[model samples]
Target: MATWSDFENAEPEMAEAGKKLLYQFGVGLAFLATVRKDGAPRLHPICPTVVNGRLYALIVDSHKRNDLRRDGRYALHTFPPVDVDDEFLVMGRAKLIEDPEVAEMVRKDQVARGMTSTNDELAFEFGIERAMHAKYPGGHGTWPPKYSIWKER
Candidate 1:
């Protein structure tokens, strides 16, 4: 697994493209998929933040949070584009961020971005195992969209 920084350092363009797709509306948003205790998949909207080159999400106490606590495996897909089929997907494992200093930094970043967060929210940092970015310049009309896939090497 690789940190966001490591992925970015290896493939800056891919990382930036993925980041752009993730934060398409000036705020980060993605569909986070986790595994339920019954081994089923659970999907939910999440606001993902890339701070100091690390990907973090603030999750309140819920089934999603509990899911991560029990099983860290997750896959994140960008919300569909308004006028295009361009998409980004990442597969990774999440680690709960417990260090006070790191959480404080994230809080400051969220405040600066005008995003509201509560004290009950827990932070989780994602470690990327691989990612795929697809660009559909011609939208649905295109025969095949350009694809760029990256894996930790």
Candidate 2:
């Protein structure tokens, strides 16, 4: 289990490529895939934040959160670009972010955003096990795009 910082240190180019695709929309937009209790697959949109030397996502009380709690394995993929198929994908483990200060900061941010704030809020830190980024041409559908991939040693 490696933090985003660790991943960056290990493979800066790949990490940067993935990060760019992730935040291409001016926000950390990606879809999170988690394992359900019954071994089914569950997915949800998430905003990944890279701060404090790690990757975190604010997922309030929900089945997705529970999935992470019970099983940390996850796969997160960036949303498709408006035209190009450039995208990023990461597969790794997730753990609850328990730092009080970090939690407070997130709570405040949520409040400022006018989103519902509650004690049920759960912050998760994602550890990167592997990642890949694809760069497509014509900013649209293009197969066999350039791919940069990395994995933990």
Candidate 3:
């Protein structure tokens, strides 16, 4: 798996496009898919944060957190665009952020951006195995969109 910075370094344009889509709402909003204990999929709306070349999600104490803890596999899909058909996605393993300093910095940045409440929660950074972006020529009506994909070497 590669860090977000590594992905960006390898595919700058693709990474930037993905980032734009992920934060298109002026905040981070995505559909996070995690593996459940039963081997089914659990989907949740999530706000993701990119800080210092890393991608993180602060998860409260919930079933989603438990799912991630039990199985780190995850796929994050960017929220649908209102006027376009552009999409971004990343698949990876989520690793708990054990360093308090890193977690605190992420929390501070999220607070400054007014993206979340001041709550201490579990933080996980994604170790990306693959990333992809799809761009349509027009809106959703367009057919056969262009796709750009990257995978960890």
TM-score, every prediction: 0.94, 0.88, 0.96
Query: Which runs of model 3 end up more than 4 angstroms from their true locations?
Result: none
lDDT of 3 by residue, 1-153 (tens): 798999999999999998888878877889999999999999999888789999998888888899899999999999989999898999999989999889888788677766876576878998999999999998878989899999999
Colliding residue pairs in candidate 2: 83-139, 83-140, 84-139, 84-140
TM-score of 1: 0.94
For candidate 3, what's the RMSD?
A: 0.9
In the range 2-27, model 2's lDDT, one tens digit per residue, is: 88998899888878887787777776
Q: List, residue by residue over 1-153, the lDDT tens digit for candidate 1.
A: 798999999889989999899878877889999999999999999888899989888888999999999999999999988888888998889999999889878777766766788877888999999989999978666758889999988
Count: clashes, candidate 2: 4
Q: List the global CA lDDT of all models.
A: 0.89, 0.83, 0.89
The TM-score that candidate 3 achieves is 0.96
Whole-model lDDT for model 3 versus the true structure? 0.89
Better of 1 and 2 by lDDT: 1
